[model samples]
Target: MPLSFKPVSGLRLRWSRLFQRAVIAAAISVAGTAALQAGDDQPNSLPPVLQSSKLRLEARLAAEQGDFLHAAVALEQAALVVGDRETAQKAGAGRQQLEAQGGAMADFQSLMTLIMEQTAPPAQWIMRGDETGTMTPYMQGVFVGAPALAGAMAMTFDNSRLSTAAELARTANSNSDVLETSALRLVSLPRLEAEIARLQKSGQPIPADAAALAGLTEVQFLFVFPDSGDVVIGGPAGAWAQDEKGRTVSTASGRPTLQLDDLVTLSRTFADNGRGFFMCTIDPKPQQVQAVQQYASRLQLSARNARQETQKLEELLGLQNVTVAGVPADSRVASVIVDADYQMKLIGIGRRDGAAGMKSYFELAGRDERRGAAMDALRWWMTVGYDAIRVAPDRRAFEFTGRSVRCQSENQLVKVDGSREATGKADSANAEFARLFTEHLPQLAEKDVVFADLQNIFDLALASAMINTMDLDRQAGWQPAVFTTAGGFETQPVEVPRELMTAAASRVYRDGSIVVQVAGGIKVDLREVISNPQSFTTAPEVSSQARNASPVGQTGRWWWDAAVR
Candidate 1:
């Protein structure tokens, strides 16, 4: 048993460093364009081929230095500047050269995919409002000021690797759903008369039938003894039961169950219980638990680092928080909150004009995109950065004491504590957003690469609705399965009650998100957490019909998106 909850370093941004690269790239691009176009007024003399080539070279340099977004934007701008020139002889030749040169775009795509897979904000982040108009994030994403930087930096880690490992473990243990880690117990009590005879012959106290023996079922046990320190038992179903006084009931006899404080009585009772069960426990030493936590933390940090790199790219491309508010009408950003933990308890966009306003969550954009590409770009930009936010903690510590039960049945005899210390850390969304933008925003904007289709639409709400319909909400920690493809990952189908069609449908409408329901839409979140492909027979069922109402026709659905994806 180990504490599953532990704090790991989060992704952090280096604002100055990112901004410096953007400025340099923009300067080169603008200067090159001006110099090349000096002689020609009707058509630029630099030629699309040379422009693309120069941009390509710049991309190579940026990527080599780990400025992926800048690199990607450079290549993208080259393409845009040369649009339709793909048919011209010079343009075709240049395109061929660019394609032939181990292009960086593919690498960019792979990197973005990895970031999306690895990055996830905590499940819930708390936003606090101060009368002074400054806000603080509570839980996981926090910022700490760097000495003399005049601004702050926000950091948080990722847990994708742990999730992958756990997933792999589950896949390998398909046949054994319940992990066997502790001792298993099996016992058969002899008849009262037989027990008495055995006690007499062995010069032992007679076991009493009136005595109570408790058993645990499907429980794994971690037990620590004064000398042994730690041991793990598989299927620990039975242990010496503790009485009301919180003392170990070591033995049963005609007199009364007696509490034992020493190993003599404990060992004698187990020996007396016969060879029916072995009492084992998982490691209980604090250090042992800490060791597992460190392992988890390492994995978390790797994920976090990867995520931060992705965020850097997003910020550089102007694909994160492309919208911000409250700046003086004429004020260019004087000081930016690099890691502004953009969190909202609620956000609603007016159906009439998409004038979105947020209540608990801060608005990254001062004004909503009015229409067309601006709207699309705004959505794409916000989506790309959403997974990087999380809750910040006021005071963090790292203490935990929890048990892991592994068995269920007779001879249970294991108990141990192994949870790790809980640590509280700060989360600052404002600081992160500011750092990414202050340096990289202008460069990305100049390149005109304003949108990134890097949105993660796993849409927890859709997944949960599907699960509710399946009636699996009663089960705790039953996560949805995911299946990914070229189009993206599809959520696992979930189990639901036959009657929750309308309830599920309404949830989808409220979110205004579209998903392809494999089965007409019966509200199944299992699509995301479907580990047992064989066990899942029904796909999610969706219909154009309103939630709860009967289908109007054969075309009517209970949980299908009316809007095309």
Candidate 2:
């Protein structure tokens, strides 16, 4: 009856190995079955090839037949199997085309490329500028192409500080011309130099600026996406300016001039290096109104009653309209002015009237009671805190300055409640409750407290009840309520809710000009810049220039691969 059992280590190991083999066999069988099913559904009419060109043709045929999913899958398999640069590049292009055709299976590489296509400054634009600064006092234009295409993109920036409106318009036109011409020159620089050499040989006059081409700084950035998922950057070797002595000098690193060949080497380095691709609109008041209206429509659909409540609140605030206007000046800071029209709801209320309203709102606990208290707060705020609102010259934006009125102050407390006796002694109980609920409970959750922990749940519930009670007391004009024990009530400092304190701490009340930015449906991808630095330094395709000459209607800014058709 007392027989002992001995452990068998070899038996356990053998069983584990057997289980693993069985699992692997099952997985292989499932995969094979799925592949066979797919083959049955869409029989490959052509032979699978190791060449990128053949794969691309196959993929294109599939796409034309509205089979982008199969095209993407086939191209990806070819790229992986062939493992060549050209095949990989074709795979990348195929993926983009599939995405453009509303395929959802695009990988990270293609997504990155799409982002770059949308945001990266054109190669020509990059060549013209040493560096690009964001949020500067200038207007920027971005050009993008169909995801299926490559080598045709650009962006431009125009200064907004001309003296007159007419002058600004004229300058913008001139700037566009300058940017286009500069792009053309960069792309055709080699041809131009060759022509210049021929002219010199034939004893023809060469422009004085012809020799300046050799000194043009070449900017190269290498983006390496290695298998280990690291991105390494290389040089931006060329961005040179002429010194006082008429010698070429780099604007940034003071490095030696880089040539086109050097840029190619850098690109090759990036291709060999990185694991991932590099990572890095709107109008004025009528546009603002349109956006608000659209949002309102959605809100109405979701919650009609809530929308009605919001309209009532807006009416109570007497907010007619708010406008934002910007003035372009010589300074780096763009000046924005906001003007607002207000018609105070309870403007003519006297002190007696305010007291009566507070009594009705708080003591009677009448519906819409907060409206009276809000009026009192607004009247006090306007009288003691706000300055007169003024309209700007354009009559679009408004400017006004005001400080927030603190209701916790003794004067403000008396102004709102009419008595210090109404302000109950604050105790640490409420503060403790807030800390336990807002801070400690969240910490417990982070610490992986089990759902079965009844004690923790009970503590949380107690804290929530305390917070609710405090909120109710505050609404009844008995804020900072003191809990009295058998002994007596202890006088404590007024305790503000942690949420209110957080909100107050985050508020930025400043005297600086306001800038209202409307996005222009563009973004920048630095990875693209790093990968193709030479392209930026060369002449853009003439077809790209033609496309940029005209404006195209834009759909929505955001797009999903599966929904892009």
Candidate 3:
């Protein structure tokens, strides 16, 4: 098994260099907006038709440089600067030209869709503090940043394409909601793919079992059959429906519904260039952080200028960037991890309530004893957690017993350039926040579906990862299913989020000096856990279960209830 988790310097920003470095090299040409929209403000200048022609030329130039994202971006800016003037037809033509010139059609189209969904942010980002003056954001919408180009930049994934033309497998979208519920349901990957292909060829609607993956919560059991060329994972499964946030969750247990999309995505991830892990980070821009820091230094911090001071802070701080590795940023799994990180930060900052034992940083720092602690930055994040993967003698069965997500914390010194460097130690108050976050997460997840959904996702990742890591497919004599092959099962593209604005606010110190805090991100690396010898344990119970967990003689059916103990 080739597993690796390379943790960077404590405060290093971890955007995928493939996309970020290339975009930086390209220089975006945002200054060219003036020429692209010549006809808009100056009627006497170039006509709208000529404007489209010029945009086409620029798009071609961008595409020629192998920068399809920028090429699409050029057209998107034109549409915004010069509204509705042959932009669609021009874009269609541009798409065709780019495709002919060696650009991936899937990549360009994803970029176009992403750009169309973004709009320019206002000049000033209006921000307010809590009654106690903490810059805790509203959970749902307050942090929605809309810096058109920057947001577009952060959301773009490295050339890792989504599986083609996802149909979302026609689950809850249809009327006839066929479903199944069981304590331990077994799913065979080969069987699931067969059903998907059959439904596709027949033009039939897929049922909940196939689409939502029979509502599987995790892979508690791994069963393989070499003779049948099947790979199956069994776990607690039940009927599921979409929640108010549009997430799929089990109707019975309210845990997240495991979808075919995630399975396909994770499978492809393991197969993609042998990438060992996936990660997403959302953090404040260093330049903006620096600017905000400079601005904060000059602030008078008097009661009279409080509101005005806050407006300045928000305006300069702007939105943070999102970056991902080992998967497309637009993939549903990436969004789940990023959103989970965000919600956890909210819980930490007193923006949202956590389960009983977890107190927010505000609550902890507001204590009379800690009034003047010198911590400038608080970093709270979640990472891979598993106690051990207990394996059977035959290596055909494995049992994992652990929480899927673990919380970690750090204190850093915000640098002069707006970057952060590890302070080597967290204040007792800061440490307590991270401790409570990890301890009460299970209880908190019971109240918040996003956290629960994240746990489920990583669990599936672990299971899928194990199959890939342990060479279980080879052991089972199974070939890669439709998952990584061309024109296989596709996942529907959901809107990738724009830059997340800095979740920064102030808590006035008793000493009258203000320390500005900014940024939190996700760092999920499973290499160390999977590669460590201690992570794997021997267990005979799994071998006994693997003997009976087979789906043999149950052809055509993809799932089944486990016989009672």
Candidate 4:
């Protein structure tokens, strides 16, 4: 039988996982397969030229395997090699062809097509993560999140799999145009506001750099300068460029850059009037679910009608409703979590491939037969992963540290009435998928920038929450300015969907066992995390971080690579 699976729910705005990971700033620098022959006069065996040839080979292989996006990406990477124009030309041409043929996202689309031909007449479909789904004859094939950054740096892909880094090596001379990666970075809100105000009064326009928040992708440190004139945030940063999907990312590493809009949106979410948390979920409606339950209980077992029966179930269940809380649906913060959740679903159901160690539910089916047959509907999700959030004694400095993502799974039993009861007994194979998902997340992020972007979003979210919770703004006497309402900073508007649908299909075994797979969800609550007393340990350095990493001397600059000190 041909492969059949559905996209995860809640991705309409997922163009926010920032669409898809494509080529980055430079060619795949360290790895490639063979030497190249550019021309007669030119050296055919230059390092870059050879690397480009090898990468192109890799791209071809990936395309053969139906991994079109990543394959085309190899071509994109190969096209960037500086020495040979021939390598660039062929690689570029290959990239355009691969993309035209569906690019990275084509894998899932292909699966859906096969499913329609093999499983049921109408077949399942891809959907907007935010849209509520219905089990109609046709499902909308929508999966792009629509959030355009105001003055978003023009992508240098310019978002083809439709979408989607850094740093500091410039030691020779002071060429301000060169991008550098920083292990630690600091930005002061009050100081930034002051600078913007100064710029405004001088009748100057806000440069793209200021609007994009200086290409920052993480926030690990929050420090207040003495006497209220400056507040600073610090974390790893590097050279950045926009990808095809309209997101700012590190040019060198391809991680999503944290935006000023996210920080501000999260601040409000953690504010006194806020929900103290953020969440995006795609769930089935009770009425439809109940209808499905009745069908399941009464259906006769047979391989002959398994596909036919499953279609009935999907029709009854219909599309799900996407719900977002604690953050604006149109905010970049909303986009990241939604996209991440959607992608995780794709990996689980075999719609998209993850890193080496990770396996989809389809791949792990027989490995743990107990959980596979014992549980009917399984759910998986991504949440915050934090070792600790320590504050300095005086509460002037804070450290928000954590891994990019955490995965958890459970078996859910749908009651006769359509309500779901958490079984919490994950099959061994299911458990392993979650474990591997979390374990290899960072590696996965390298290949797909969305994973990294999610990490950056969570870091900023937690940092923003900490700032609000700790009243760091009051300590620094910082008021919102440039990235504020009065400043008229326009950020990417997160795509909002009223209804979300599931991408679902079934596997009919020769033995008469029918397995229907559904995607999982996302739940994030910073209030509970922040309120944990143990989560907040006293760091002696809070008192000294301001004095030690003081931006006291530099008045005109907005941010800098801390390594320069």
Q: Which model scores highest in lDDT?
A: 3
lDDT of 3 at 85: 49
Please list the residue runs of candidate 1 whose C-alpha ends up more than 4 Å from where it truly belongs after superposition.
1-70, 75-348, 351-376, 380-565
**What does the lDDT read for residue 229 in candidate 1?**
16
Model 1 agreement with the true structure over 404-489: per-residue lDDT tens digits? 10000000011122211111110132223223332342232222111000000111111211222222222322221111011122
The ten-residue window of minimal lDDT in model 3 covers 20-29
What tens digits encode model 4's per-residue C-alpha lDDT throughout 1-565? 1112233431110001112111000000001111121233332355875666655555543322223343434555666764445554544554455334322222244323322232212322112235321111111111111111101211112111101001111111232332566666666666666766777789897666665667676766666555635567766667788687767788867777777667667656554445444555555665665555455545563556655754665566567655555567777666666667767877876767899899876566662241233214555655566656555534455566566467765444444444333333566766777788988898899888768877877777666655554556666666665554435545557665646456644554444344555555543333334545655554443333333234434446667555342
Q: Give per-residue CA lDDT, model 2, range 193-274, as digits (tens).
A: 3444456467776432333333332211111111111111111223356545333344553422322222221121122121
The CA lDDT of each predicted structure is 0.19, 0.21, 0.51, 0.50
Q: Model 4 lDDT vs. the true structure? A: 0.50
In model 4, the Cα lDDT at residue 190 comes to 64
List runs of model 4 lying over 4 Å from the truth. Answer: 1-178, 196-205, 300-312, 365-376, 390-394, 423-425, 481-490, 508-512, 536-548, 563-565
User: What is residue 471's positional error in candidate 3, in angstroms?
Assistant: 1.0
lDDT of 3 by residue, 1-565 (tens): 1111111111211112111100000000111111122233432256775555555555443332223433564565456455764654555465455434322232343344323333222111111122111111101111111111111111111111110000011011112223556656667787788788888788887776777887787667666666666677777777788887777788887888788888888777665233334555554455665665555444455534544654565566565555554566678877776667677665664556889999866567643323332224555556566776665444555566677666665554544654333332455766787778777878877878878878777767777766765556777676665677464567877655656554433344444433323334344445434545666654433443443354445557766655431
Q: How far is candidate 2 from the true structure (C-alpha RMSD, Å)?
A: 33.4
- Candidate 3 Cα deviation (angstroms), residue 273: 3.3
Candidate 2, residue 227: Cα displacement in angstroms equals 49
Worst 10 residues of 1 by lDDT: 22-31
**Candidate 1 vs 4: which has more TM-score:** 4
TM-score of 1: 0.16
**How many pairs collide in each candidate, listed in order?**
114, 22, 1, 37
